[model samples]
Target: MTIPTLEDSGQGTGTAGEARRLAVRGDLTMAHVGAIAGPLRAIPPAGHDLAIDLSGIDRIDTAGAWLIHRMVQDWGAAGVPARVENASPDADRLIAEVAANDRPVPCHVPRGNSALDQLVRIGNAVFVITENIGKILAFLGQTLIVLAQTLVGRRPLRWHAVIHQCEAIGVNALAIVGLLLFLVGIVVAQQGAVQLRQFGAEVFVVNLIGRGTFRELGLLLTAIMVAGRSASAFAAQIGSMKLNQEVDALETIGMSPIEVLVIPRVIAMAIMLLLLGFYGSVMAVIGGGLFCWVSLGIPPVSFIQRLQEATPLSDLVIGLVKAPVFGFIVALMGCYQGMQVTGNAESVGQRTTQAVVESIFIVIVLDAFFAVFFSALGYN
Candidate 1:
């Protein structure tokens, strides 16, 4: 095949104006583009009409078509009439594609007013939050329906899966949960003692540790830790299943993915969170009692006695009630985000991170609501 060449014929008057004709010959593919591109673009000032002849092109590809399209656009923008002529069907289609895609990208320009920009951002955030709330509520409704069906014996519960999840979420987390709460308890007791010592009321440190652990710190911290650990795991596990089409496989076999995968996890999280919260509270109390005995000269027995007298049964009840609700929220966020995953591994990772962050945020928000609610009810 001959190398591509661009030949400029002498100018002549046409219907529009004086016109310069450029003839492109031979195969107009990537291999020949470098040979002809410079000469084609080196034409005199763009005052005259220009016509590019492609009829002599034996072969053409996207690269050559783009070059021709660019030259036409450059001259056209400079007040010269420019167009491709005598192009074969394939060449015309390629050039048309190149021309169609040669559009300027839109750029974002910042508004001058900072307050208006802030308001716009706030509105967008509110819109996104409202949409996500609706989705989570819908998912909650579906989960409750499936759970009710299992309770009524209409659908079988997978006991083995539930047990496995319980072990993973609760039993495996015992060491970390116990250790962290113990440290928190020591901090609370030491701080309380320091403040109360000035007033000669150091013994009241027992009240601080006992009421705080039983009512707030114990369950709240447990839920946050579980959200970080188990919520991410649930999202990753189910998201991987989604990526591999295993969730689709279950549906194709007439199995509900919610029933087979989600119900057991939700049940296990609720049950384990309740138990873990109680265990963490006990560990915290132990640490507080140890601190009192060593630092304040308050014996373990006196510490136990003061704690029993100071902390109400209502405080324990409040913590217990909130544990399962927090657990359900964490599990729901994880499973819902997992089901929403599509496309590839990146989606799984993104959903997993979203599940963890959202779980923790929602848990803290609910914890605040519970605090206000119990306080109004005289539980404080």
Candidate 2:
């Protein structure tokens, strides 16, 4: 029985009959093995002259050659003589010698799609995002309800947890923040003094630092540190719980993991960020004042006077206002990434890193948004 001719319409220098040429191109890895198989096995049985051009082939492995061999077999089975051409020296020798008896293998067939497939793909994506958004909103609402309940529930604040978190978030962080803020204040004050001195307005350095620190620096610095410190901690803790399936166990036991695990930590972070902002403002002013007095020869009383005159109460309030929002975003990102963690210890570490990076990024973005918003509202 004569096997039907397999049509070949791939790119070559000439038309189909003008010296038939078969080209194999693209990755030689398993990814394209099946794609190559199709054209190769479809060679016409009436082939007068055929050349398996490996010209476009860049890299090749055993799998690639096996694919090519299958095509050659089909040509031979069709009683059409075919010779491999343009083969790399290595590939040519290998194909002619080793894989000469290479038999045709069945190509992998991809799962077919039906009408339901289109619906499923679209519906699943829409459903997942909707569900996730709902979860996030519910999480926020439930957290707020829990916070309100705690305030009125007549249960004394969990001073122990609060104190523990304070020590970890505030006390343990004090030295690093103090040192950094001190240096930052000095740098900012000195820089401002230099420009002000040019205009004989050096005393304004005090006002600059005072207003800038309380209105922005204190909050920004505190949020950044917490994003790095506390957000990372949340991710690590929750990721560890996830790794151990503790979150699952909590869910199974009828506990709202968001309530039990997430809310308290978020609340603690918010409180700690507020305190840190206050502390940083004080420290930045002190350091900035010292820099102005000693380095710029401005008197302490004069510096304080200028600062009080230049900085407004609104600046202080604005800075404090941002703390809870920032804390909320940081904590939420940490918990979200932690919940997404899978795999192993490596995944935990990776998720922790991602959580901190994402938290910091989100913080900066929100800070910018607030800056522009407040500017428009005439609050800054």
Most accurate candidate by TM-score: 1
What C-alpha lDDT do the candidate models reach, one value each? 0.92, 0.78
- For model 2, which pairs clash? none
C-alpha lDDT of residue 352 in model 1: 95
In candidate 2 the C-alpha lDDT for residue 124 amounts to: 99
Give every collision pair in model 1.
Answer: none
**Candidate 2 global lDDT:** 0.78
The parts of candidate 2 lying over 4 Å away from their true place are: 1-142, 145-159
TM-score of each: 0.72, 0.64
* Candidate 2, 1-380: lDDT as tens digits: 11112234543444455556666666665555665566555545564656677777776667777767766766777776667777789888766664766556679966677887999999999998698668657656866776676778733355566567667777888887787778888888988988898999887788889888998888898889888988888889999999999999999998767666776677778878888888888888989999988887778898888888899988898888998899888888788778878979999899899889878988899989988988999986
